[model samples]
Target: MDALDDLDLRVSGCRACPRLVDWREEVARTKRAAFADQTYWGRPVPGFGPPDARLLIIGLAPAAHGGNRTGRMFTGDRSGDVLYQALYDVGLASQPTSVAADDGLELYGVRVTAPVHCAPPENKPTPGERETCRPWLVQELRLLRPTVRAVVVLGAFGWQATLPALAEAGWRVPRPRPAFGHGVRVGIDRSEGSVGGGGPAGLDLFGCFHVSQRNTFTGKLTPAMLREVLSTAARAAGLGK
Candidate 1:
């Protein structure tokens, strides 16, 4: 297991962010039986991929009834179901199902991470919390060296968190990085003080509307669109047939 794997053991009852801790605990009390005996992994969910994973999926934060409750990123949620199906179809996952934490699913060469590890109230994390949670992401990126070639940022928040890391590594992001439509690729280059974002950043950062309830409910993103994005990203990552 990578260092990322141990985050659950380290801080499930994390107190780093007081607001998140209180909110998660509050939910745990009301829905105790629903999550009976299950450890609320309210801590940061680390990246789940091999050291040499080619694609990195960055999400915003954990869901209260989802990742925090199930102890797996994106599990026990609708968004996860869609995301996992697309991932399996793209040949990056070893299993086709991601219904629950113990669904016996596995990723082949991709890892999913959230900008903020803790599940935020109403699924929205404040700016301060996002900032507080970013250091873990940076650490994970550093340990995942020589393997991450591309990143699929799920939303604007995720995109924002990941861009600076790429830029510091010498990947130049085009001004504004344009807008958030899928299948778009803007270049990234390290700015003047970007120590981590230097050299020939082989990572291709793809932006997509988050696989969230809002997008799914509004029909803004379809299953086909998700599959297409996954296919494109996987081919770029050299995982496609």
Candidate 2:
């Protein structure tokens, strides 16, 4: 198996965090009423996309009834619905809907992942949990570094988590760090010490509001806004407009 595939297998088998392990298994057993007949994946979700993807999208932890149930990042939830649709509109995804792992949907030049793989209670992973789960992200970043040139981070949590992982994976993250805000973009170089920006081989980091029900339902993040962000990031990743 390829390194990315092997890493994914390891990630899915992770049971390092006691609370997450118990909670994920419990949620699987209880089974949401709407999906009672369906079998939950009940394991940590892994990054989904081609290993040579030039663009990467980072999100918060998987949703309890979403990735935790479907075994794919950003699948089986309203958030995924919003995200995949935007990706499709921008030509980054084959379809606008991501309902299940084997649904035949595909991403073009893009990969979707998260800082935390497990479904945290209330969608909030504790600080300790994030730290415990970070090695997996670090390893994934290292593996993707050769081709990944741009990143779109959804939400403040992902932004905070990704910077450290990026630094550890060989990028020179700016000091005082870049703040998280919709439409914010920061350039990161492969070497440390200098932080001018827009280096030829550097990575571009774009910030976007999370595609959560809260943001979408309140119109804080509209379809047009999401598409704009995805399109801009895709272009920066050399995926064409």
Candidate 3:
């Protein structure tokens, strides 16, 4: 509750990334006629899951009508719909739907969050924007301390953002590790924390092509592809059924 409470406050009026803030606000303003009464929360979106979550799902920025509209990470988007369905299949999520705030979705031990909170114009965030958005991620990781067993990065950028934290926490990569693809897993030696007593544990990082239209339409990512990654992460996190 402590960490979640702090994150809620931190995300309320976030201005860490000026470019994203300005762009998000502009988009909200220009489309105000239609969404004015909708209460656009053009602020940092917080992670959703358990305080002692064992799995971390990393994604890119929110979409215009996705998390940006629903105010919950990954909600109200095609990507989220697919993701939640997969999580439901793996026994992590109770609902196969994540369409809106009232979807009543619940994650067992999985947390979902985006690299960038504010939805960028055209869904592409600049490198400067990514840099500006890094701090919140760092803070989030710190608060998530002991329970994280593996991080399932949804794309290249998500992997990149998570790598440094893994490194500083004493994680190491093996030689000839392949680039991100569906069902790729890399185990890292980490010193973040253990269940209770402070100790070292291996953090498994699984990578998959994002569930975006670009990948899904091209068949680069499919339900089978994503499910493989999910199974791998679950096995690593000791959540296997």
Candidate 4:
């Protein structure tokens, strides 16, 4: 198997965080009222996208009823509804909706991952849990660094998590790292281990508001707002020609 596939297998089997492991399993066993008939993934969710993707999207974590149930990042949730539509509008996704893993929704030049793989209680992972989950993200970035030209961080949490992971994956992040804000952009020097291994000098990072229900329902994040950010990043990543 390829490195990405092997890493995904390892990620799926991880039970390093006791709290996360228990919570995820319990949720799966109990099942949500609306999804009681469906089986849950009940484990660490792996990143999804083409192996050669140039656009990387970093989200906070799997939603309890979304990824934790569907086993695909950003699937089966309101947040995903907003996100996938924007990606579709910008020509990144083949379809505007991602209802399930086998629904045939495809991302053309992008990959989606999260800092925390497992769903957390109250939709928030504790600081210790976030730290424990860091290694997986660090390793994933190491694998993607070469091909990834641009990264879109979905929220401040993802922003904070990605900067360190990028550094650990050998990117030279700025010392004072730029603050996160909607449409914020930062450039970081890529190291020798990157995909091209020689010429490409840097990677661009873009920040966007999280597509959570709170944001979408409150008008804090609209389709046009998200499309603008994604389209710009996609262009920077050399996608959507």
The numbered model that scores best in lDDT is 2
lDDT of each: 0.73, 0.91, 0.76, 0.91
Counting clashing residue pairs in each candidate, in order, gives 16, 0, 0, 1
lDDT of candidate 1 at residue 235, scale 0 to 100: 71
Task: Kindly list the per-residue Cα lDDT of model 3 for residues 1-241, writing each as its tens digit.
Answer: 4866687678757887777788777765565455566766556677888877888899988877677777788887788888988888888898899977777888988889877788888899877777677777766765665677888999998777777655544445554544776567777765544433564456788888898988888888888888878877977787745
Q: How many Å off is the CA of 183 in candidate 4?
A: 0.6
Cα misplacement distance, residue 169 of candidate 1 (Å): 6.1
TM-score of each: 0.86, 0.95, 0.88, 0.95
Question: What's the CA RMSD for each of the models?
Answer: 2.9, 3.2, 2.9, 1.8
Of the pair 1 and 2, which is ahead by lDDT? 2
Over 111-198, each residue of candidate 2 has an lDDT whose tens digit, in order, gives 9999999999999998889989988998888888778999999999999999998887778899989999999999998764423332
Model 4 RMSD in angstroms: 1.8
Segments of candidate 3 deviating more than 4 angstroms: 32-37, 169-178, 192-200
Q: How accurate is candidate 4 locally (lDDT)?
A: 0.91
Model 1, range 63-182, lDDT digits (tens) per residue?
887887777789878899889988888777877667666778889888888888887888889988887777677666655545766778898878777765554345566776566657
For TM-score, candidate 1 versus 3, the one ahead is: 3
What's model 4's TM-score?
Answer: 0.95
